[model samples]
Target chain A: MLDEIDRQLLQSYQRDFPLVHDPFGEIGRCLGIEEDEVITRYQRLKDDGYISRIGPLLNHTKVGVSTLAAISVPAAMIDSTAGMINSYEEVNHNYLREHHYNFWFVVAAKDNERVDAVIQEIERKSGTDALVLPMVKSFYIDLGFKLWQSTQAD
Target chain B: MVTDQDIIRIMQAGLPLCPEPYASIAASLELDEAELLRRIDAMLRQGTIRRIGLVPNHYRIGYRYNAMTVWALDEDRIDAVGELFGAQASVSHCYKRPSYPPGWPYNLFAMVHGRGLDEINDKIAALKKLIGDDCRQSDVLFSEKILKKTGIRLKNRSSEHA
Candidate 1:
């Protein structure tokens, strides 16, 4: 469980990590804690697997590409396929879902062509045909969530 | 350097869907568009602006079929295991989460989206062939509804929105 100060820290920093040279210093000033404490706690959170990363979330469209991919792995082979998929730097995330297309992941690249090429490589290597679904239009949403501060309203 | 006020303005205005959005933003700020572009380019290079793109309202967009997939594998093979799913294009996000309690079989998490259930099923089949027999249990956490989706403006002064 997180205390009020911890919650506040997450609310402030989760989605938008400050861009300054010394972000911990800026965050420390806000929390009235030492910069080193901020860094230590954050590192602790990551080490414990509470937060996956502490960095910028780039705009893929601006870079000219992004893809939302999914596959149906047999109840048996998920381990091997996940290992193969996550190894590629182009593949940022891989998830196993409840639906028939249980294996899903996202691939962001420099453009649509590159994104397609990466998908093809996966198909060739894994011998699985991955369905490519890129974002056509987004009405509203942000993927970032605050697990540390659950008391805050979503 | 960007101030809290600047962050507010950028988040509130949203990214312009124009050919030259940074230039358009600069026009409003009364700064040279070229200089503004240079700053934005630098910020991106430095990992300041994580992403500038559409926030998918999957429900509103009729993409009701979405799920969080999880896999449990021996610690030794995690990296090799995760890479298989990550390479696919359908997956939007993936990571290694802690294993579920005794009743659950999911250890690795990935977010996959589809137009409907049928399409999602077909994709899952192909994945099974790829991973082999050590998959353990794969569970799907379908999203029932969207709670909220808004970018965080790191330096903003107001907490009222929170």
Candidate 2:
């Protein structure tokens, strides 16, 4: 469903964006399109849920602390527990996965105290002990992939 | 003077979608565009901001399957394994964390993306080929459903941010 330009924009713009007064203009220049078209396409992409946002992916350790906490919630309480955890603004990414620790979510905040507090609160309130696995070291992998690599390879 | 924290607070929400996005951000903070751009550049230099660009949701972009592939590897071999798998094109996020044995025993998390289970299986087989013997056990945890999802929310200085 994606056109060539849409595919290019999605593939190429994952990182190293131009920092300028008119960044969209700069992007337009690179892709041989007008600034307005770039903006409109990006906006449509966001609306269509193809792209989330255009911004900096923060280095969590440098700015704020975060933890990948998982809780083994029984099926009966899955909905209630997810709702409660989602209520917290700090819990941005929550997923229902297939495992004993079925309820997995990320808690990110300005400090470790806030991170711990949220986890503790979840454990106490839900009566489900959480496995708090704070990131020790992040091994770097390049973000984004060649969405059309197979076709392009030929 | 606009501080780095202030910039962080503003940018946590996301870059604006307009012709002159940075200028608009600077105007909101009542700071000049040059100064704001300087701080952003500084953050990029210092490795605080990983990247500044458009991020696509994997599923929407035809990557319908993503596995938070976790491995319980021997402590001595974890570092080697982490570096090896981290370089793979299929793996997006690879990290080393403490493994709680008995219930959870996954210390290395390699978040892999694939078009479907076939592609994922290929990548997994490749990974297994490379990380032989070092890995004690592994499990693939797929996201059955998203209970809640927000792109990224950066907390302000004990205040609020999107």
- The numbered model that scores best in DockQ is 2
**True-vs-predicted CA distance for residue A27, candidate 2, Å:** 1.7
Give TM per candidate: 0.47, 0.92
> Tens digits of per-residue lDDT for model 1 on B38-89?
5755756655565433232344334567766666767666666676776665
Q: What is the DockQ of each candidate?
A: 0.05, 0.75
Q: Candidates' interface RMSDs, in order?
A: 15.4, 1.7
RMSD (Å) of each candidate, 1 decimal: 16.9, 2.5
Stretches off by above 4 angstroms in model 2 are: A150-154, B156-162
- Give the distance in Å from residue B98's predicted Cα in candidate 2 to where it truly belongs: 0.7
Model 2 chain B poorest ten-residue lDDT run: B153-162
**How far out, in Å, is residue A97 in model 1?**
1.7
Computed on alpha carbons, the lDDT of every model, listed in order, comes to: 0.57, 0.85
- Per-residue lDDT of B14 in model 1: 48
